[model samples]
Target: MADFSSEIRQGIQHISESVFMRLCEKVGTSQRVAMRRETVDIKEMVEQQLAPNDGTIQMLSGSDREGFRLKGSDVDHMYWPNDHRVIMDMSQSEYYNMANTTLILSDSSESPPGFTLLQLLTPTTDIDVLLTCFRINDRVFISSSIFRQLTYLASLPNSDIHGPCVSGDVAGLEYDDTLCFVCDYWPPSASSWIDRCQSWPDPEVVDDIVRNGCHFVAVGHPLGPHANEEWRLSFSQAEYKCVYAMNHSQFLTYGLLKLFLKEVINHNLGKNNTLLCSYHIKTIVLWTIQQNTLPHWCPQNILVGFWVCFKLLLKWVREGICPNFFIPQNNLFLTKVNGSAQNRLFLQLHELYKKGLACLLQSSSVRSYIIDVLCSPRLYICTDESIIKCEVDSDVELFSEILQNDKTLAQVFYSCMKYLYKVQQLIGSHLTQNQVVMLQRLTASILKNSSFILHNMYTYTGVNKQMYIADKISCHMLKSAAKFGCVSDMFYIAMYYYRTLRYREALSVIEMSKVKLAQPYLMYREHVDRDRYTEAVGGQSWSTKMRKAVVLDIILDNAICYINELIPEQQAALHNKQHMLVIPVFLMFHFLEFLCYRHIDTTLSQAALDELQVLVHYDQGLFVRDIFRDISWEILGICQQITGNLQAALYSYQQSLEQYPLNLIQTATHTRIQDVVSYSQNSN
Candidate 1:
């Protein structure tokens, strides 16, 4: 529903306001009217597209500040902030001539002797992206330069000799070049500058960094003259989204991140980079910068923490200095965004594996990596049992391509799995309403690609093992989920306990859960019939599975009990008051029936759907569309299949898929679906 996507705007002159107003409302309703207007003044547009503090740059004309450039930040702003220009005057020309070709130097340390330089544009536009400079009369000792690629520019000094300044080397930066500076995160040496910076940015740079930016739709021959487009930048600002004023020094690191993140950016000029480059050019300048210099990046924790990303990337682009940044190779970024999840952190982590199969079309590289990491089939998880039949045949057809030999592929899939687990956890109410909304919108916008999910097949594997760490993540998410009124986590917790055969505990959780449902009652009944034990058993595998299920059941039971306390039952008119004291006396126990229900499917298999069905049938008051959409249909279909009704399962799956229509769906996919389509078509 976008007014014009980079895909849509490829060949349109003007998009009718009426046609795409809905899209404008969703992404940038406030700026659409002002954005659609055509104007010949490219300078005005360029200035507008600059960062929030762009005005501060002009104001600091009188100040001695130098070596600073601007950069564009997030996608909230249109792709190009200062990309359109009609070539008018000297100052204006410098802004628009930054297209065509630009050189990319990965790390400065890779280059020896002097500095590394790459040609930016084919010819030249009015814009200058880099401000190169060195010391005054000391060519033997260089200071720093700034890259023009952020909302505002860093006013690095040309004469500030790095002296004995040491830059740190990152170990695994090659991972996410998507945002690599020196590499990993902050190395040890680069983190000492938290106290070194005296100046931040000029005042003008502060004024222009804004929230809503100008949008332009222009095209011509690629890199050809007369390719007209509108551009916008400066407007308003905020703490998380705006530019700072007096405390400019606080944001130099922000400027640094914009540069090295491997993102094509847009912005206006901030300080003078080429100022002293022509006069003073000599010594090696070591740039020290990183994202957050707190804790690990703390000047104390890591001896070479300054090379961390976000900040290090900024330093690399601005000051033309790059050193290895340490990226953690041991990241199991699946459950928690902070590296791991709490409640089933290890459970999710264990799933942090992959079976080299992308719809039977495997990526050899990914397979190789998985084999090496998983140590045979033992390390991987296979959701599709049917695929086992085709494994030998697939290898025969694909030859060695099916072999998991590529290390990079394994790493990538591992990363994907990690992301999926995190995303799964994120689906709970723990995220902010805005974050939830954003995630849903994003999900809707991007079709749920099974392949994509397979790509992040293992985002995190084993981030950390500390029980406290997992609890911390769970605690944070559970709280947020509570606040936003989204208790996906609570539901899962309750289910987990029931699965482990903790009957009493599971009942307590369901009764206390904020969400009122008869499923808890049903689970309690099931648990009472099975999985209950007085003491520990000695079967190892049986015990482990039972233990995991028990924990989950206990958690669920606690949630159920909590609900009773939350909504003190309507004053019992006929009940004895003395028995009310007994009502408060609750036993802490777990249920195994719910655990069996919960563990039925990691992909939310038919069991969970059946539980939801019971809730819908017995508890209309607890039914909510958002909680678990299409569960009734899913259960009905699956139940029919159990009764040898294949047609019903297919129909039910189709209904479920359509019931929760996402934001974005490929038209191609609409005509054909996996679980439902083939069966339905064959039957027809």
Candidate 2:
């Protein structure tokens, strides 16, 4: 690419790294260490009483256990009673009798967020037993032991020293808000109800994560009058694994996302509002990493990734649906924030996008760490995905056998194609890994062979003109491929329409592709032969579904809108075959469209200039003797000036003078850069 002016380079780096540094400060290492120590102590204390017999009733959770907590974050401990059968077999009274006989029962009427804890005073530390029972298996035979255990604990047994051995509550557990711990029991069956997550994640990663001992947590219903009995399986362990696997840049990106949600988005919406949480932000980051390639996540491109994730969050917020990462059925935002509040959060994020990072600039110790490197061009290059390109060329038979045996191959094929389509530009192609290239070739081969087969069938059947193949076969081969879940074909077919200038037809195909995208997730229940596919339908988590939706939306909003939003006259101009179009003119049109559609103009202008610079570098033929070159240069300077990069603006103006055609050069214009810089300095 074209060299960015020093000032613009410095500005981008300062803002990006400043935001990143602030996030590190917010989730400082010292705090993480303290939280870890406290969590270990709590786990040890809870285990001392509960773990000795069965080694079951013990496991601390929350950010402390997950390894991504901010300072002073609440550490959650789950006292998993391992006597699954005994806990479920006994009656409420009998269960109470058993628990009371084993440990000293406390009548401390304090109940924490989810459970009823039995307070215990030890020699060194005071701990509470969360009288919760859970299961590791999903079989219905596996009982809801935790619920029964809690029910037994909640029984009333009056005493002299403790005021009352048990409270008046039917289930010994009482919700007193003052209790340091409460047992939130998820029955074993309920706790392990859902474990079909094998369909969504990469097979390699899934194996690694499973090996790390990720089990479902028993989470109760969000909208329960008494959610004690109704437990939902949780993927918190899996989620923790996903986060912990991230490289340094990925971790930083995730931290930044959480900070944006808290310090910026949540800050804008009042504290009382149930704004987006760090969990939701973390979920978004996990999905982002899974969907994109390794090259796409290079350290230098962390800011781009952060921006992409923020946009995804905005889309979810605007839709008023933040689904639980592992379960699509559970909408995290259902009771969290209403439409008005969601709208406010959306607007706040939109403001950040428009105003650029300058809106979040702060004078703090965090910002000081990166001050020297803030101006380094290495971290602040124009790293947008718009400039990447993906291409495929392969024989039709290459992946035929794989597609036949591996149902998930089709889905992967579709994802690869969609990824390629989004990143491809006329210049500055993105680097693709071997895996992506292989998938692309395999998908292309399948599509080519299918089309060839269909053509041959038509030729043979149409010749007789009676009982034709189209009717008899209905293209059984393609239908079978579709049944096997070949989503990539739809994308390829859509591109054909898009390229032929059939805008409306292209839009319809694009819409259909989205339906096909969700087909596996939605119609999964109906597919009896689930084993045929490495990934079963309906197995996608909430984050997976949202990620797919966001991908489609980006394609539609950016690529499709380029066609749909064109005015009649502009549309007509595009159809002219004889006339040549300059690359800058076409790109500038898109930049203007983005400016018109968005709430802010500065970022759009910067992105547009970045694209133009890239184009000039890779495809100089497009700008040689072209009038748009001068326009691009002058506009770059103006955009830099608007964004408060005076030195960059001066450099851009100087470049503009150099690029001007012979007839356009003038002495008055030559001095413009110096004069503008002098004026800006005096004003400052």
Candidate 3:
């Protein structure tokens, strides 16, 4: 699809300065924005925003000028210089492609192939989805306990819980419920950019918005827009209660909150969200996600680490790193080293190498992408470093004498990495492991360490590695192969590609591994996971083999539990069109063909799996993992004793855990392993 990042960055900076400033200049002079952001107005964009539009939606509308306000809106205004072509291209890509090719409008023709792969994998993909999870308070408690409370999600053996029952209507209607979040519609004229920002028609649009989540401009003087508690309280409150810190009521703003939410979900897809923020504010210490751990360690979004990385990179360069630096179109130039600067960069890269790629990517998804993207071979890096002992040792190194050792350098490096990661994830990241390896190799070779990798990517993998390597190589070769080194290397490799903003490359590297990374997609697991997967399949593969492999494995391996979730219509649909429906389930069943019917097929607690089994015929091929079949059956024999029946509660649990790869559960699975060991655990 279209590169949403550039538009987002452009939009963000535009909102901050050009949009906010001019509006404020006009409105600050008059206390209002001239138009509503909700409407499509051609005149407003051309004349006011000073931006062009593709033939489609003419102008951005705004009516609720006072309801919302932009604070520090001019902070990053430089990124949004008055560029008409940029704006025009954004409108074109969004209106023509992104808008038209959405899930709701899917059809044989109008339906893009991207959504298909994602469609078939829903039940399994959704197994890990957190219904209404969020980090409350600074400590970042997880909501799996809440998920544990839900009989339905809990019904799926491997699924984890989110928060207490936070239904959309009643999600925040609890005793602790703070301000009620609202996005009520505004009249067209009272519409302003803020209104448009608050309302998105499509989930994809919303996702895009979330990723490029708007940064709040705290309105009140010192603290900003977040200062207005009056605007946040519930309308029915009698005597005002300062329930929580930041007045939960007035707790808005503070730099792209939606982006932060996406990050939280990315890191904790099916795993517990224990790292939720603490409810009380004063004790709210800054919770920084471990450079590697992310939402798991702190599922809540912690932008500090990312900020450090970005700031450090900026500091090192003493200027802005052009977005083009990471995604240059010319291939030959990709590897061309520019003399001293190149050498200097190479030397600095050694430290990164020593720290290891895993260490680099451990934090969140965005960091992984950042490291991978910037790691490209052609980057102009600084080579050697001299102390300038007497302040005259070298030209660029001349200033090096004033500072001290590598610790300061290390700190700066750390900051750059963190910032690069957090910033990119906010909008989107596009790096991968193979690219990271390529970058590592490129960096090592430049530093006279090129031979570190077992093979040259361009030669072994191919030219234009981004397009050359398929998802297969990324997993079967790069991730699983011993040569690329440990997961850390792969992770950093992913981060390197991501920073260069090569989202596809970044995603490949992270997704290659069996386990989830703490990156943004993982942090905001449900949304990014679904959105990206859907986007990749282009709408046609959702209900097919292309669905995420892990999800498919879970479904087929435990066909019964999945069937249990379906209603009669679904059953009739599957039965009525066995010719058609069988294909998708068949694909999942076949993928885990290594695990047999005698095991998974007969093992389900729900009658659904059994019903599905009778509807289709199996190929004559031998089952792959026959050993797992007996092993799983043996475990079922024990559970049978506790539940007192062959097809009781134990059977469902057994069926849920049956078949498929063991590793998927190794991470997200939460269980009470047991109180004591028993010798009778062996017999089937």
lDDT of 1 by residue, 349-388 (tens): 1232121111111222122332342343233332222333
TM per prediction: 0.25, 0.36, 0.19
* lDDT per residue as tens, model 3, 1-684: 023476544432222222212222222211111111111111121222322221111111111111123321211010111111111112233332332221111011111111000111011112222342334232121122232343233222333222221112111111111111111111111123223322212344333322321111101111222122111111111001111111111121111221222343123533232221211110111111112222221111123223333233323232212111101111111222335544554454344445532333443423433353345423332211221121111111211111101010001222323332432342333433222322222221111111111122333455465434433333333343223232223433442333334545554554454253232222111113444433443333211211121121111111111122222212333332211111122222322221222233344322323332332223222221332332233233333333244334334334435544231231111121221112224333
List the candidate numbers ranked by lDDT, top first: 2, 1, 3
Off by over 4 Å in 2: 1-50, 54-56, 85-205, 208-228, 268-272, 362-684
Evaluated at residue 287, the lDDT of candidate 2 is: 60
- CA lDDT, every prediction? 0.25, 0.41, 0.24
- Candidate 3 or 2, higher lDDT: 2
- When sorted by TM-score, best at the front, the candidate numbers are 2, 1, 3
Query: Candidate 2 overall Cα lDDT vs. reference?
Result: 0.41
Clashes per candidate (backbone, < 3 Å): 144, 18, 146
Answer with 1 or 3, whichever has the higher TM-score.
Answer: 1
lDDT of 2 by residue, 1-684 (tens): 025586665555555554444544454332332333333432233224323333334344556555454542444434443332112222322434343233222211232222222212211111113333222232121112353443334422321111111122211222110111222232223222235434345566566554433232222344553244333344555565565566656776776666556555656554355477777887777766765633455444556677678777777878887755554545667766666877777787677778654434432333444454555535543323222211100111112212211211111233333433432431144422322323333333344334333343455464655335433342343333333223444443443334334445544555565465445332121122233222442343322322231111111111111222222212232333101112233333333323332333446546655664565435544323344454355545554564567787777667756763322322323455666778887998
